[model samples]
Target: MNIDVPRILIAATQSGAGKTTIVSGLLAALRARGLKVCGYKVGPDYIDPGYHRLAGGEPVYNLDTWLTDEQTLLNLFARTSQGADVAVVEGVMGLYDGGAGGVSSSAQIARLLGLPVALVLDAKSMGESAAAVALGFRDYDRRTDLRGVILNRLGSDSHRELVSSALERIGIPVLGALHRDEMLAVRERQMGLLPAEENGDRETVSRMRAAVERGLDLEVLLEAARSAPRLSVPSLPAPARRAARLRVGVARDPAFSFYYPESLSALEERGAELVFFSPLRDSAVPEVDRLVFGGGFPEVFAGELAANLGMKASIRAAAASGVLILAECGGFMYLTKTLRTLEGSVFEMVGLIEAHSAMNARLQTVGYVEAEALKDTVLCPAGTVLQGHEFRFSTVEPEAPERFPWAFQITRKRTGATSLGGCAAPGLLASYLHLNLLGNPACADWFLGIASDASDV
Candidate 1:
């Protein structure tokens, strides 16, 4: 199917340039104009998209070039952004920064999807020099469609004027010049911007809308979003095929909210009936053939998670019974023997895996990894070359022994660092890497097939 998607990507010279705020504000501002807006984040980040959805009143999608291939990436954008008046994609880190060689940079996404770009530059400490910086980004890679610029954190009218005129002379349009306003800043925590679910209250959204309305030029954004080339791709992915139905329990709550819509939809497409339950509050694991635990702020609720002895025992019993269980970062921690909080207090976990976890003040690791299964397991052999992402402020304690059976052999894309992760058994696969099943939907097929075969009762 052929479609025309008027899309624009919001990128920054680097992180902390207020791009997330700008993107969120812009989403709110555009939606406030009575336009149907679809929001997307350019990488594997799961936090910014939450703010985007809260700001725009829609389900935000992730467009990760690392997790999903180019075709799958375009297919996702095309399928998700359908029937929207416009779409805004928030970029990660810097424009040209991604996995080594700028593999999945915001600039790369813009080029891949043939979309225009509007850069957000931090102007707190610079004036005319800001133009030089903008010029470098625009010129660094001419292939990227550098359409306009947003000057964030400008100190004054004079500062905005100084930067705008210099940029105008170089043929770059200044779409907006936003003053440094405290009201625009969102709450943040140890990892990054706090997820909107935790931080985007009504007052916060109102404040963000006001800030963007006051400083952003909505007409310029719309114009740039529509100025992109016609969207063309080989073809849309065929619809998912259904098979034997199986009940799959999914743990979802404030503590376990890291699931992607596509990943879950992939399971449904494979004929698995997804049943939502909560490890945070549910006293017992729901009756299902399989269970999945996505990542979230499980460590923040360590005390409550430990307090719920019944829930922990339920999960442990289920895992021990050989029920297929798949978990990511925070979920992986919850499966361990204990979780040591930042305060050094220890809390008992499910103990399904023979390891303990510790919440660290600093981020232990963050990057894209290619995971190769170390042993035969559901979805391991068929989908061994899985693309995954990891970002957490926690680590496993008394790390898995060198000879301990590993679920996946993970190789960091940037540093080539290799490590063994998780426990892989006949009916279990748990690890820190967050896998997008749509990237390799075969995994979902394999996973659901195992769920069906394992139900011999």
Candidate 2:
């Protein structure tokens, strides 16, 4: 399928280049101009995308090449960006860093979508030297057309002038050089930044709003957007496979809302009805053959979740009865026996799986992962291959040996081996690893396949 979606990607030389602040400000400024702008994050990042959503009233999506195939990624990008004037994609880490060994970087995404790159370079400590960095990034990839440069965190007006002058020699337009502002500092936690949900305090939200307004050059960013070359692709039709299953219950709320829209759409394409229920408020699991619980902040709401006896008991009962359950990080924690907060408080969770999760003051798993199906579960049977990423700060310690074997063996994108949790018990596929459906479209069919087969139960 093809779609003619006009888009631009906000990339960077590397992490800490102020991409978040720049993207956030750009999105806010565009929305303030009353433009219908949709935001897309380049990889499986939960935190940055939260800020993106807050900056604009658009739903955020993760686009990855290694985890999701090219067709699925484009299809999702096309589908989500439909009916919008422009699509703004925010790059992850660096413009070129992807999974292990330089694959699946943001450059890969920009190339795949045929979108221009707006590189944000940190120009605080550099002068004419900034030209070398811009030239290197532009020439290094060759295929990834870097359209413009955004000099971030400038020291002074003279500092901005120096960097902009250097970049001009290389023919890259400087969108704008933003002055370094301490007030633009967003609060941070073990994970990159506290999610927008957790930081909804009136003072904090207002502060963030004001910071973007003051720190960002909105007029300059819009000019950059206007200067972006148009991208044209054939209109691709949505997948037309008939629905294969019906009424699949999805776990949602602030605690479990990390699902990709493509996942639900794929299921719907195969004839599965998607239903959402809040584990935090629902008294019981929705009456459906399949249960899907994606990732979110179960650790932060551990106490309230543990005290939700009705919902906890219902979820446990559903899992124990062999109902197809597909749970990710936060959902993985919800099915466990207990959750230990950073403050040393332990709250009881659903006892469907004999495991306990501990919230640490630091992150436990970060970055992309490759996971192959080891055994039959809700999503796939033995030997089914899958690629995804796991981002979380909660650590799980299994209580009983042989109670639940890991669902898949994890190989990190850049590093060697990474740890993950899974259960072999009938009708359960839960893990800390969150898979973007765009990367693995097969997950939808796998989930529906198992759920449809379980209609008799």
Candidate 3:
């Protein structure tokens, strides 16, 4: 099927070039014009999409060619983009930064979807040299549709003109020029921008929209988006038609908010109804057949989580009764016997797994990984292989390391290094690796199947 989804990818010359702020502002500005806009992030990032949701007033989706194949990615893009006047995608890092061959880079997505790119160039120090940078990016990959440039952090009107003229001489259209304003900045911490849920303030989004309205050329940007050719999206397989026979409790709060929209939708499509409950604030776990905990900032709220002894006991009782559980990253940290912060503070966790998690001074792992199931588990059968990504700043130490039932033999895609990770038991699997179920739909089916059997028992 061929679909014409007017889309534009807001890419940057490099990281720290303010593309997130620009994209968030653009989404708000477009929505203010009474246009139904959809927002997306280019890779496996969960933080930036929170800001996108704040600005766009819609749930943001991810588009990653690494986590899933091109066909799946295109289908997801096409499906999520339905009923929208335009789609705005925020790129990851620099345009060309990704895996070994730029597999999941913003440039790759632009070329794959034939989307026009409006490069955000930081114009803090140089004037005409900005053109050289834009020229380099434009010619670096001829396949990339570098349609225009947006000058960010301009010092003054004169500065904007100085840079805009230079870009014009090289035949690059100047789409927007935003003056440097500290009020438009979002706070950051170890991971990246603080999740918008934590910083729940509509005022910040208002400032971003006002700034974009005053600085950007919305008409030109829309024109560039409309210039994209109609995409040939492959037909997706029909979802299983079944009534909800299983209840899956999903942990969701300020501390546990890193879930993929499609991953949750996949479970619902396979006869499971998701019931989201807060692990930090709720005194009792929701009555459900299974539980799911995705990655988030559990360590930051370790003290609060530990203080909620009732919630902890509730989860423990659920696990003891053979309630199947799946956790990743922060969710993995929460299921351990204890969590130790970087400041040497220790707090109690669920103790479902006989392991202690400790925050490290630096990141322990950050890359894509391939996992081969070591044994039969709720998610998959033995020998089942899946792709996932891991980004964490903590390490897990098992009480009896030699006796731990490691779930998968993980191979780091970038380094080819092998490691034994994840804890697997009769009805629980917890790991630091994050999986997108869209790429592993069979796993979702297997999970729901196991949950159904457990509910029957």
Candidate 4:
């Protein structure tokens, strides 16, 4: 909290309440005002944070209590917000929506960071009832500081007057009222919005920026942000773990881009050299002893990846050669035998594992998780405890029913559906779960142990 950045949490009453749309515009507006802006997402979402970075020029950091401990979350917020004028944290689903225990929601983060909240209420149809939602959220949590309210998708001047009068009757101040606009919404596919990296057309991105600028009132939002006080908190000490003198290959491309910058930095801090490569473009894995694949839109690039026969073969060879590998959601899909897109088009993938994944109508895995390594692999020592989240919309179709590999046992940390688990092949570990190793420092020791053994050179 020695950091001098003034921060505010952009939260809402529930999901689909237009929080992302409103927060993105606020970020773009602040950047336009010549202020150094940093954005943070309150949960483990890969897509929404991408748009935040596109507007603010900084990779969005995830703050979640279920996946990471309170201390690590605080330090991540403090350390990442260093040298920033202000920090804007966009909340997940709803203000209080979290996993099974409902303990790690956005409101928890607000109290933990001692930051004020500006609730974005969707007022397309509701009138005075919007005030009830705002008040309920404000009074529901005594510890949370509900500073003000922003009415999004408002109908007209008369509509705003009705909603404003109701909020005034309560104690929450009305900051701004935004009218609904179709053009202001960014396009989303199965997973969510495409990461800014895949959006090739700068004009389209700029047009989205312009839409955001014109929809929400920037001045009012910035004023609300400025009203928030600075936080004075302690920093988290670096995790105590062993180091390994090995190079780990990380996937970086249009297909696999949901990697947290901190995860890679943690590996380096623990003495592992990270070599980034693109599975979509590169014909082979880097000359490293291990591999780490994060999440992204592998479904969109299915055909291209299928055509990249050389890359697929090279990955298979690497696994066969006993290279330690860790693949997350999208990375996990890429290592399968094949991947089917939403349009029924299939692409060939590395056959290191026996499964074939296909896009489904519903997201298969989503939310925080606690995974224990069933076997000693690249990610952990045998029986090591691991914490992470799983997010995917695809299901695997194996050639043989019993051939499905389950090398790890996964338990959902919060309230969400259960997942199958991880797969293993002598030094390789892959799963749809995305884990931030800083919380559970043991992962560093586990990964290093595998990397050290594989780095026999």
Provide the lDDT at 388 for model 3: 88
Give the lDDT ranking, best first: 3, 1, 4, 2
Cα TM-score per model = 0.95, 0.88, 0.97, 0.91
lDDT by residue (1-457, candidate 3, tens digit) is 6658899999998989999999998999899889999999988999999989989989899888878889988888888888899999999899998876887999999888888999999999988999999999999998999988899999999999999899899999999989999998889878878888887678888888888899889999999999999978879987663464888999999889999898898888787889999999999899998999988988899999999999999999998888889999999999999999998999999999999999998978888889998988778887988898998889999999899989999999898999998988778888988989887877887787733343222
Q: Report the alpha-carbon TM-score of model 2 versus the true structure.
A: 0.88
Identify the runs in model 4 with alpha carbons over 4 angstroms from their true place: 1-3, 199-232, 239-245, 401-405, 414-419, 450-457
Report the number of the highest-TM-score candidate: 3
> Global CA lDDT of candidate 3, please?
0.89
lDDT of 1 by residue, 1-457 (tens): 4447788999999999988888888888888889999998888888888888888888888888788888888878878888999999999899999987887899899888887899999989997899999999999999988887899999899889999999999999988878888877878888887777787476777777787788888888888888877776667555455555788999998889898888888788767899999888899999887889899988888889888899888887887786788888998899888999898999988887788899888888998888888766655562367889988899886455765557787899999999877777557778898988888777786677743343221
Model 1 lDDT at residue 161: 93
Candidate 3 — which residues are off by over 4 angstroms? 241-244, 450-457
Per-residue lDDT of candidate 2, residues 1-457 (tens digit): 3445557788999988878777777777677778888998887777788778888788888887766777667767777888887778999888889777666689888877777788988888899988899999999978987877878788888888888888888798876667787766677776677777776643443444455566555565555455555444555444435344467899888878677766566677767788889888888888987888888878778878888899988887886676778788888888888888888998998877778888887767787777776777677667876777787788777876556577887777677775545665677878877776545545665666633453221
Off by over 4 Å in 2: 1-3, 201-245, 416-420, 450-457
Q: Which lDDT values do the candidates have, in the order given? A: 0.83, 0.75, 0.89, 0.77
